[model samples]
Target: MLRIIFWKLGFEWAMLLRIIRPCSDQRVYYFAFGANLSPDILRLRRIGVYETFDHVLEDTVLNFSQRGFYKNHGFASADASVGDCVYGKMYLIRQSDAKRMDYFEGVPFLKAHAKIVQQVQGKPFYFYRSQIPLNGLKPTQQYLNYLTHAYRNMDIVPSQYTEALLATKVLKTLEPQDQTGVFVRHLSRWPKILHPSLKHYEKHCHQLVEALWNRSLVGWMIRV
Candidate 1:
């Protein structure tokens, strides 16, 4: 009964709201995409994490989400139809919590680096992104590898502010190819990669997979 109730509450309502450290972590910041606009999400975030402003990067985008850039890569010219924006979430978690988020994102696919961007409230904050842009991610080879790893490791019940951002419709609608579809395709094809603990998220995982395959799923689309 408790498990069912907990699932109903969702991660933002559960861990994020209840898990935040007291006195505010100061290092943490909130980045909302869409669903996060719900008062419940914000209230929960306030409870689970610290809020902060002041950072190195200025927010160039006016909308809710921020971009995680890879410095060395030229703009992706091959896919013109591809959406101009790539979507991601960012938060200034302590190095300790950062490690856990990293595992969920698969640091191997997403290389963390220091970056600054504006939050929903127009405040500057720090975060990271995938290194492949600078390192040259082979879409053909790396895509499969990344998708595989992400499926196995990605935490559907996201704990970070960015996770909420990625799932938002804003990013999904703008993607050139179906972003979520591509994401789930890789995960479904690969099994035995998921950790044992994620058994709890299995239903959510199947839902994502089905959503991706059906092409009927709904979410945000980025504009650029």
Candidate 2:
């Protein structure tokens, strides 16, 4: 319940910032990799996003093969040497909504960093890209530990409210294990390959990480 409250508050607070414009163009473009992929999730959240640019995370593959909502759908792996570019669907969101997306993704939750992109129409704009980081995996480790114990005795699916509670439990459980440095160091060994397709793998990786993190935690905390 606390997590849900936090998410609601977070969205409300972020929506307040939407009044301020990041670009004069009003509409902002973003690359969504997670719940945005699931129409059901969007309907649940009441977030209105429509496809604008059809994209794919060209070089990357699914990082977590299980426990995520979307993994059952067949997808390719992101290369260690060259990350895979998985297919992604793009949306033109209101600048206000775009800011909310950033707020939800940054820090405590998933981090979606902005990248400069040139659209098919030759318009230069910013889009959010997600990845493990140039230094290496992040939030993933903290996320992993939290998930390990949080879901140890729970059902695979639970009520939405219970799922939210699990999110909090996972975060609290992992706070003591903040090993950011180690994860970043590990990245040095990961393949730093790029894909040729217009798609960017980092964005997809971010979405995948976020979805898996939330769902896995939720699945582990609830009673079937």
Candidate 3:
């Protein structure tokens, strides 16, 4: 009888626990290889950014592939490249922020999420592998500025990576003009404060990197 009563009590405890904690507030670790790496864009727009770190994505290469998020054409995308590493930022963010990032990355339309993007800390790190068809797409200099700025600011990126980025050949198409200059100026502005928000400041510092790392950007730059 004591064993039977104990079993019942344990079952009830388990049920109660589930009822009280329907779900745990789980955070997500996300990696960014493109303009999303800009902290200004992540914070002012994407809330719930918890923390971040500079990381190098292994066995992958970065490039401007497919049309941009706005229509800037051929935005930054990544593909598997043997014997190469890509520089990027890893973020610890709210799960909701990760979902919103899906929208930003056009996950619903792109069908890119098959599995966790890559492994980190012995776990999967969700990411977007942008390998859209590349055909005569070119990124604006303003978009380019964001990337170069990021590199200039962050010493994490190797000199050769910056050189390879600047060396990428383009078809020299009638380069699409954009107001990215104003947007870049806005994101680069430093806040006047004694103790800036770390996450916010981290974002600022991230975007503060020289523009050479930025080869493409969101399509909405047309509206900037």
Model 2 residue 11 lDDT score? 53
lDDT of each: 0.30, 0.39, 0.53
Candidate with more favorable, higher lDDT: 2 or 3: 3
lDDT order of candidates, top first? 3, 2, 1
lDDT of 1 at 4: 27
Residue range 1-224, candidate 2, lDDT tens digits? 23334544565555544443334356766654433545454444334554465554444442322122121221112223355443345677666556555544542333223343545456444444433333222233343333333333334323452354344322122222222221133433555552211123333443445543323211222111
Q: Which portions of model 3 miss their true places by more than 4 Å?
A: 1-24, 69-72, 110-116, 167-224
For all candidates, what are the clash counts?
Answer: 13, 26, 22
By TM-score rank, best first, the candidates go 3, 2, 1
Better of 1 and 3 by lDDT: 3
Q: What is the lDDT of candidate 2?
A: 0.39
By summed lDDT, which 10 consecutive residues of candidate 1 come out lowest? 215-224
Q: Specify the highest-TM-score model's number.
A: 3
> What TM-score does each of the candidates earn?
0.25, 0.40, 0.59
- Name the runs in model 1 displaced over 4 angstroms: 1-26, 44-124, 127-224
Which candidate ranks first by lDDT, i.e. highest? Answer: 3
Candidate 2 least-lDDT 10 residues: 68-77
Compose the digit string of candidate 3's lDDT tens values, residues 1-224. Answer: 23223433443333344334323376778887767777677653333556788888888777676454232456666667898777878887655456545544444433323224667998668777653445455666655655666766667998877776766554445432232321223533646452234334433332332221122232222111
Model 3 scores worst on lDDT over the 10 consecutive residues at 215-224
Point out where model 2 deviates above 4 Å: 1-12, 18-25, 50-53, 59-83, 107-118, 124-127, 130-224
Q: What tens-digit string does per-residue lDDT give for candidate 1 at 116-199?
A: 334544645433432322222222322223223333343432345334333433221222221222123344455656633243
